[model samples]
Target: MNTFLNTLNSNNMQTKKPFKNLKIFASGFLMLTGLVATAQQTTGDVVKKADVDPGTTITDGAVRVIDNKGTIKYLQTQNGITMLSNTTANVTTTTWQLGGVLTDSTFIDIDGKLFGLNGLELIDAATESASTDATTESDAGTGTGYTILVRDEATGATKKLLATELIQSGQEAFTATLAQTTFALTGAPVLPSFSQVWVYRNGAKLIANVDYTVAASTVTLVENDYAVYAGDIVEIQYVK
Candidate 1:
């Protein structure tokens, strides 16, 4: 490559016209292009995926190799250290944790009037404790060791959504166990407005002021006439 450039410079020095044969210039240019391609191949960075130590460093310009553990990983940096790792990894994860879709479920733009529900669909939960179905919902927010976090745009603070949040979607009933006062609502934090709530006793609807107070995940009866006795049936109705 240097010899080719020197030949061009020598030809330029010899002639006031700065003349060089077209064949020689073309040959020299092609040689230079080949040299450049070789240099690029030798010096360029490469990425490889294989297992490595925890604190391994990947150079900025090199091919960033990931420690492949039979799973795909995204390149990330932490405390100015570069690594290939998972972005969505949790310290501990549950089977029923909420997340974005992995593979897309079929989305037909069927409006609210299809089967039965206007817009909301009924998710079937398993009645048994061990079965994890669509309806095996956990209401214990505080005890579940997981929290739903929401960020405040105005204050720029992240906080946990209250545990045991229940929103009644439709009419439902539950038989209160013997001596149970505060019935853990099937859905919870209580409905916003009192006008939407209706609590019923055996066959008669209980009075609002004198009967029961609906709070988050609980329906507390007044314990007088409205008090829930042993094996008393309670019915609740509310909008979604």
Candidate 2:
């Protein structure tokens, strides 16, 4: 009876040890689960509070800010909104204007690149000043009238004219003597006066009773004005 009691006691003790170990393992697992849940809750709260709205304006006078780091920004105007900067700016009804004249500087347009006007006189890169005045002469002279010479810088070609006035009264015979130039006549077919001579290249109307002759590469236009007042257009044009 004593031996049997002792063995029973030993088995009970072994069983109690396994139950204690199981209790300890269960407590540790609960603690680890609680810690993980707390960390997840804190992370969720941080994410909710860190969210922000995007910016709207990019450039206003001096300030330069973008809406998003990777997304494209836009510019808003009275006409419409546009995507600007590295992207395209699609505007509506509004055109950009350069308030001041740009001198001695180049500018870029929608076409990529272009030249600007410079110097005392506005001269474009494509076209230049045709002639420069040397000296003013009297309207009356032995050679019909005053002479105005136009020189082309590119080709070194010169055009000369005997500037005579247009008279409305009695028949006035006006003549234009060109140096090494011939003009093709069309329209009303009238001769050109001094002031009207420039109108030739200006693309104006030609009057009547106009006679032209080309000799030794020189051209002369004779006009007999029976009627017609000053400022009446009588022009002609020449090539080469």
Candidate 3:
């Protein structure tokens, strides 16, 4: 009976030892689980105005990602969230005054000036500056009495004068002296060269190098056409 009693007690002790060890292991597992929960941080249903501290940080090359199910909602590297649908609205403090696609008809507003896709200003206003005095081609006119814009080579400003005020079709009329052969072309734009000089005698066009020859700014008629009377009309046509 004593020996049987000792064996029974020994078995009980062995069984209890395993239970104690299991209890210690369960306690250690529970403590480790609590530590793991503490290490993870979560943003609950409430909106946070101030910055919330995450208990643990990610290592190098690892970034925190916000996702719904498997789809990514936001990435840490990008400026804004990855939009999944149009139903959600994201508000940010960032803003810009100028932005538009080149293919779109909308203009990009820079300050108050709006520019088109071609980089042309859409706004119409007065002159860019008082000194500019610029005029578009629309401001020009043709025919008699109409004024045309001309740039003054001296001052480099655009000025306007009647079309009639310009040289008459590049033609200058002169009264020839009695039997004058050599005539000085003082009104010619520059010294006339060779065939560029076209001479007319009394409404008749004279052949160049046949009836007359030009040298420097002077035109000398051939001996046959040299009989220019005092009252004869001589006309010189040239290109400027």
lDDT of 3 by residue, 32-106 (tens): 334334222335652222221122222111122222243422211111111121122221111111222222122
TM-score of 2: 0.15
lDDT (C-alpha, whole model) for all candidates? 0.45, 0.33, 0.48
Q: Which stretches of candidate 3 lie over 4 Å from their true place?
A: 1-169
Cα TM-score per model: 0.29, 0.15, 0.31
Clash count, one per candidate: 9, 3, 0
| Candidate with maximal lDDT | 3
Residue lDDT tens for model 1, 45-87: 5344343222232322111221223333322111222333222
Candidate 2 weakest ten by summed lDDT: 46-55
Model 1 TM-score relative to the real fold: 0.29
